[model samples]
Target: MLPSASRMRRGEEFADAIRRGRRAGRPMLVAHLKTREADVPPLVGFVVSKAVGGAVVRNRVRRRLRHLMRTRLTAIPRGSLLVVRANPPAASARSEHLATELDVVLDRLLRGRRSESRTLTDGRS
Candidate 1:
């Protein structure tokens, strides 16, 4: 499980972030990330809608995503807010498939961030 303070729980705030954040997509998930002025580590928000399945299924998906982040997201930079949404296909995905997909998305997001930082530092668009 991710630490309490590292979780994003506010609905309106999440909506705002999703609207403004940079996006990275994969087969099983979509990630929205915003760079914040806060001093804390990344605050992640996970979205698993009812369309994924019944109550049990949604919770399972949420749990799996959280676990993936707790350990894997360490590579992500600080002061970032990340929201990951589950698509309908996630209802049928096995844990291994979901895990691999999350890893791929994170990798892509981090790569984008690095390139963006270099661009900013070098005065390139």
Candidate 2:
């Protein structure tokens, strides 16, 4: 279970992250990450729509995602907002597979952020 403080609960929070964040897409899920300058803990949210499945399947996927994010909280940057939107395939994905996909997507996003910051510091586009 994810800690309540780390959860993104409001509609605007989710919208801001999804609209302004960098995105990494996979067969199982799409992750959006928006980093902030504040020193607060990272916030995470999940979107499991009906396109993924019925209530039970959506809830199951959401639970799996929450558990995966709990273990990965430290890896995310401070003051970042992350939204994981489930693709239909996630409904049937194994926990291990979801973990792997999440890791891959997160690595891409984090790496992108790192390179971008490096470029800015180096005075290059």
Best by TM-score, which number? Answer: 2
What's the CA RMSD of model 2 in angstroms? 0.6
Model 2 bad stretches (over 4 Å): none
lDDT tens digits, residues 1-125, model 1? 99998898888768866998888888779988887777678888999988889999899889988988899767766778889999878888988898888888888878888899899999999
- Global fold similarity of model 2 (TM-score): 0.98
RMSD of each: 1.3, 0.6
For model 1, which pairs clash? Answer: none
Q: Which ten residues in a row have the lowest lDDT in candidate 1?
A: 72-81
- lDDT, candidate 2, at 117: 97
At residue 61, what lDDT does model 1 achieve?
89
- Give the whole-model CA lDDT for all candidates, comma-separated: 0.85, 0.96
Tell me the TM-score of model 1.
0.92
TM-scores, each model vs. reference:
0.92, 0.98
Off by over 4 Å in 1: none
Question: Which whole-number lDDT from 0 to 100 does residue 64 have in model 1?
Answer: 86
Candidate that would win on lDDT: 2
